[model samples]
Target chain A: MSSTLLNQVAFYLLSAIAILGALGVVFLKSPVRAALALVANFFTLGLIYFMLGNQMIGISQIMVYAGAIMVLFLFVIMILKDQTPEEDKSLFQDRRFIFGLLSAIVICGLIWALVINPTMQSFGGEMDRSYGSPQAIGRSFFTTYVWPFEIISILLLVGIVGSIMLAKRKF
Target chain B: MNTFLNLPLAGAVYEDIPLGHFLTLSLAMFALGSIGVLIRKNPVIVFMCIELMLNAVNLSFLAFAAYPNSHVQANNAFESAMAGQAMVIVVMAIAAAEVAVGLGIIMAIFRYRNNVDVDDMNTMRG
Candidate 1:
């Protein structure tokens, strides 16, 4: 009934939802369904960010990912008439299957290595209380990371212009 | 593994969430994303998986930044703790831009080919 126990339970539940949603994104036949699953995953990940004390990132995750990006995906899927080409049934025979298996093995190996390695273990630390706050993030953004901040704005502007150029039917 | 599972969280608060737990979760998510990218032929789905992987990496960065002995927080400087957060912000911006440009290209391709199957788009194949 303690706060830590609550956090642990929430963490486990959210992670389960995230993993399931991720699986749905990959395996679901309908692109719309897959996009919906991805929305769930993004929302859950946003919650996890909040739990990690990253309020700003958490909010942005929901706003940018769940809101803007997902809307774009849904719009595109709808425009494409929701036609997801059927998946091939022969699993093991496909060359892509081999690639999938190889990558899976590599990932599993990496996980195993982390599990066995002593140095990779987590060490307890005290976080600055205000580190994850929006105010703190804003201060650091304006002061320490101002250059990158400006660059990002320009990059976003370029993306807007480029997307318009590409999607436009006429010059 | 037993030791990790038995990490002392009895008296721990929110901040006491074990670093290993975060790392393990991040790795699992990353693996899932990689697998999704490898097997799924849908470009949109592949893009979602890439976003998942990026989120997983962000989790690890936040975990490390919160670790007391991490290099970023070596001197207990408050600004240093924001390093990972700043990086994540930048990554998020890049990801947004990528999605915009990527979807634009996908739209263009769909207009030309009338299909969204990436397998059919072999124009670059030498």
Candidate 2:
């Protein structure tokens, strides 16, 4: 029971950080500052993943989002070197804001009706202690998902080749 | 009065925190991301918002994997978890590939234009 209380505290704290960082990513004008906030958000999410007992995925989240994807974003932002792009002071002036608001409302209603209203089955089952471990995830990847795993490699390769083609200057 | 207090966390098993809290967190993050994508003009920031949205989805997947519903193949809960974890692995790969291809496109645009704004890039608008 005490452990459950600890989990709740940690979860709330991480959630707060994640949400704040997300807000920073959205509202901050400077791309570099926004990217840094996003890094913080990703790290908090990774910690949450660890708290949830997904050790392997927590590691993956850190390595992939904070390390690789963020680097790509920072590199692009540096290349662009734009400090701030838009000058509109009022968010209401942006026509797209209304659409975003509408979509959010629609999504909220749908989720409430579909997911929250339903009597969900409580997660009463014992947590599978060994399932989320790195070795276990790796084993399943190589065994059950081996062929499908190759598809990721193929996708990455295609991304690499296509990016090179698209980015290369016409000489 | 006690029941009212338990209403929000009604069916929680309490071995850990309620899964509903996680789902709510995911929903909030996704909503924020969508708003950011729509309201923000910076292309790079828009990309970050999309990443946030994807991360939110990942959070829900992990939530389910960590605390799978008792009703889902109770005898084989481990298998269901494996499935969720596998899907998350797939999502991560997709996100990585997307970033690679996406940032490359952005760089290409940077090479072409002195300033990049979503409102201005309408060459293919139908």
Candidate 2 lDDT over residue span A1-171, tens digit each: 454566677789999999999989988878899999999999999988877777789889999999989988998888788543774678776677788888898997799568854524455576555677888899889998997799999998998898889877562
Candidate 1's residue-wise lDDT over A1-171, tens digit each? 766777788888988898888878877878889889989988988888877767788889899999999999999888876555677777557898688878787866777576624435446555455687889889988998999999999999999999999988652
Q: Each prediction's Cα lDDT score?
A: 0.78, 0.81
Measure candidate 2: CA RMSD: 6.1
lDDT of 1 by residue, B3-114 (tens): 6423433213345466677677777778778888888788888888898888888877776655555433545645555888898898899999999999998888877777
Residue ranges of candidate 2 with Cα displaced over 4 Å: A117-121, B1-14, B73-75
- Can you give the TM-score per candidate against the true fold? 0.88, 0.89
Task: Show the colliding residue pairs in model 2.
Answer: none
- C-alpha displacement of A121 in model 2, angstroms? 6.2
Q: Which docking category, incorrect, acceptable, medium or high, applies to candidate 2? A: acceptable
